[model samples]
Target: GQVEGGRKISSNTEASGRFHTDWLNMIYPRLKLARNLLHSDGVILVSCDDGEVANLRAILNDIFGEENFVAQFVWKARQFTDARANTNISTDHEYIVAYARDDGFSLKGVGRDESKFGNPDGDPRGDWMSRSMLGLATRDQRPNLHYDVVDPLTGRVFPPNASTGWRYSKDKMAELISEGKVLFPRNDDGRPREKKFRSEMRSEFIAFRSIIDGVHTADGTQEIRSLFGVDLFAFPKPTALIASLIEQVAADGDIVLDFFAGSGTTGHALLKQNAAENLKRRYVLVQLPEPLDPSNREQKVASDFCDKLGKPRTIAELTKERLRRSAARIDEENPLFKGDFGFRVFKLASSNIRAWEPVAADLESSLLKNAEHLVQGRKEQDVLYELLLKLGLDLCVPIETKSIAGKSVNSIGGGALIVCLADGLSKDVVERLASGIVTWRTALAPAVDTRVVFKDSGFADDVAKTNMAAILSQNGITDVRSL
Candidate 1:
């Protein structure tokens, strides 16, 4: 549902519950991070029950701002039992709160079925539909709509009902009549209607259903049961529901990020939906490998399931397994699908740069070891990805490398970032390499400023490093740094 007036209103959370203050504290910064990660047109949906819904909304308001509050979707799931609650009423419904990153956020509207529209009159424009031109408000509510529409051809006046007046003002009615798009009835009692043309429809699609219907919490458990042959995760969000949400906000080529990747339903749904529709929607799912103990009642099934699959016993492990199984299922169902769905897992690690830990007795030796810069067994790809994270470049951004003076130089983000981590750069090759980079940068013509990074230890001596920086600086490529 759309926010009323699309206006910024001050959120009144003074009376919100304090029971979940600790939960709110942890989620506040994460919401801010999610906002920063969103695309220009991206949106976020958070799920909660009645107990903490108000508190969750309050923090979401504080982080995303009250103005960006989009909707609070009601997922009406039938509660088989709510015996734990002391209240008289059973809590059968849950809420999914949504917020936009900016003003550009909008859900994809559903298109109107054209079967109802036809060119019965055969107008030159296109198929036309006659619609009632009556306003929903009373004469008191909209005084302007309570006006007379005179048929000039017959010179007869038709007055609107006081309870429901004409849809448009007198001036607009006159304009429509002049344009021959208004239908005046011959009978004195019949109301006038609008000749809306198929070609002139304001928009092709209408608002999608606001209420979540049919789907239930049991459906989620059943879906996992169907896939795993046992209920591995309890109350997992249904892939169908997540797919519907993804379809509404994310178009082709859009990215969906789920920081709390529970069961990887978001990724699973995105993959299945995108493959079915041949869309290029991508996703980034961040799930911590929370340890799961097989002996623990809550996690026993999932942890045992992970063990049977010969994987680590963690929620994140199962999340990845869910995605893999979902993709394999999609491939089996659609053998000719061109296999456009897949994901790579990247683990969080410390920076590849070797830190210098100097003891007073071993200061000189520590300096010598630090001279190497990169840690032992660290690959170039690891360092390259670390550079991407530090630079805030998209991890999926295009990266290409070229041989310059027998050394591989990498170009990233269409040359916005240039890197050369090759070792053993001599003064003789520095000029040639720098010159080649300058020539390539000219060809790239990136829309933004370029930053060049090199391995500090790669240079043979200080003179080689100075010469490389000097050559790049002289050619309007001054932003240079060493690893």
Candidate 2:
């Protein structure tokens, strides 16, 4: 049932065997792209039920490597009593498999459990908690750490045992004692403890455990129901569960991505989390525009929603609608906690530029006619984005349009790069534009690798084209080119 709506094709492969191969074929390229998209210090958490956990792990291991496997968090997806009708056992849990880009990764802990931390002694350093100073290393393993320490306050000596040695060396112990960071008990028989101050703690990170419970499927279902007045999605993940995973690995203002964004749950959770933490975390969600089959009972409500909203009957349309309603609801409920709950939507499409392909019979005629390169009817924004891809620049960079010499120019990354594809470029306009961009470069970015690009065939004549290049080169901005 889970794989019912999958794309079908006639093949010699067995039905069950085809499923695995097809699924992996779809996922493999996406995984490769996701890895490239992530920052080097970033981590990814993927949720899956028991149905494909084994296969998923093997694929992850092959892609991210076995060493980069961070943890497998087992979440209670459903209650024990939520049994499947045909199966003898109920599937009550799911896995959140995590992997880092490399060995360099650490999760920020769930903020210190304040219930266990307090200034019991009222030490000026701050609220402190005590931990055992003894480590599991034996005296033979670390003889330097097998030392005795005298508590300055209690005048009591603590010695390392045969099985466990003192955690710190004599010099380190003395340093801790001088800083009043070591807790000395009144009873001389007690072992000396290390005081970890809330302020001085190097990192507020705890190793995320492998098992996560209590976040149930009911919460996720309730979330969708609350927004849409009905359960439009099947087995949507809990917002809290996703938020917790995100908070562990991501920092404020980091980009969160979800490719399988059913019902836009990830976006909803990000908005709620950002509102709570006063963060500017952004999200990138990708959901296929799968057409809803009204014949299927599960998607009937969603299909009806599409009709009600007067939108196309597609999953992506519903996903976007959910995000819109969720953001509006959050704003209404928490007016004071204002943060960006908005997203700019972009659809994937073929390049706006026509690829140069010579016709065998009329190669010369075709080449001359399509010299402009860009396809007809392509919007300015489309051309800009295509150029961004060609230049290896981030498509989402802040773009600002400025009128230079009466022609519109697009400045990206705060004047780090400027593009002018307007037609009919004259020598006078070219000179004025070059001077204006130089001024902008000095004021905005200043020696920050400014580059200027133009339409190759748009120049009025050879004199204008040569003048444009000479003017830019004279102004200490030689990185000029034309498409």
Candidate 3:
């Protein structure tokens, strides 16, 4: 659903717009809500094309704070040849904005692929990769970094280049020599230069730049065609492209969500990443169940293909099918990845219970029209999920729902939280709730804090609130709030 307080004003022919201040107003609340959903050490990755990149970045900087910005990744989606000849500029890349929930969030360093590291010499120190040791400093700029390199085998001193100096001082070279980190490269004339083994390198590597150009749009298109045996979608991102970002930013067992789950590409990428690295990362994908235009030729082709394959015709159906196939592929490739994909389905709908209608006909109609504002098209469970997002609680956290006094009460994290969404709470119910608090106090483990959240409309009167408060005070339950 479109978030409130934002106007969809058209600006360009392609349905783009210059968002008004209300757009920022709309985004702020969602960003704030999203921030509350993240773990203290979690991060959020937001993707945007050129249309809203600047505005999104500015909004994020304001909401998440400038210091929390991790990086803006630029993914080149198309080839240079795809550039428009008239403009002489290729608009092929999209930006993914990243921000940490807090200063504590950080990426685990990228590990070197074992296949990429190899040692030709077969030294006992294990596989190695050669890297340049050249320094940018000139002799004039850094005399301390300039020195002669002695060929350990030939005893010939190689002077520094006139323009550039050595990377280390004489004393540092001596220390490296003593530690056996430097290798003397042999030449035809029996002279040698220094070689550093990969074993001496740090276990983790630093994060790379944000620009990515290896995966092309053709790669993405080809991947979809090969996996599904048809080109059903346009401009799908390559699984590798998304995997690279996930691997760089997310950790094992982390939750990665993509609200604009176009073609289920993100889910495919997450599955592939987990299979390749033996990680246990989870994913949440959301997409509008936009209906396909059956009259269109391309849509007809897609429909026919799905019919032939005994699949459903809607976009959501196709999206789920893609995920199913991706999961199957992972399972086929590695049994360890089997049964690793599952999702809880939730669809937005009007609340199951109706609110009280006013006695007057016109007033009742108005109330019904504005019902969406007072009551959401969501259930208590849905509200709880949103609250969890707002509170930064993990989706996997255990939630127990019990029917206490004919009310569906939810307790999360082993009584750490008690939520009552029941409407029309009476004094008798409030007294029972107070008694329930005492029972919960005894049942809850020692030193574990408990909190209760109630709907403001639930209580019948102030006397009920007073009674509840007095009971909670007696039971040492201070954390309570009314929504």
The C-alpha lDDT values of all candidates are: 0.85, 0.83, 0.74
lDDT of 3 by residue, 201-272 (tens): 666575666788889878988988988888988888889988988887778888888766878989999999
lDDT of 2 by residue, 237-329 (tens): 889988888788778889999988878889988888888788888899998777898889988988998999999999999899989998998
TM-score of each: 0.70, 0.75, 0.66
At residue 430, candidate 1 shows an lDDT of 94
Model 3 residue pairs with clashes:
37-389
Worst 10 residues of 1 by lDDT: 1-10
- The residue pairs in collision within model 2 are none
Descending-lDDT candidate ranking:
1, 2, 3
- For candidate 1, the lDDT comes to 0.85
Which candidate's TM-score is highest?
A: 2
TM-score of 1: 0.70
RMSD of each: 8.4, 6.5, 7.3
Q: Kindly give the stretch of ten consecutive residues in candidate 2 with the minimal lDDT sum.
A: 1-10
On the 0 to 100 scale, the lDDT of residue 118 in model 3 is: 78
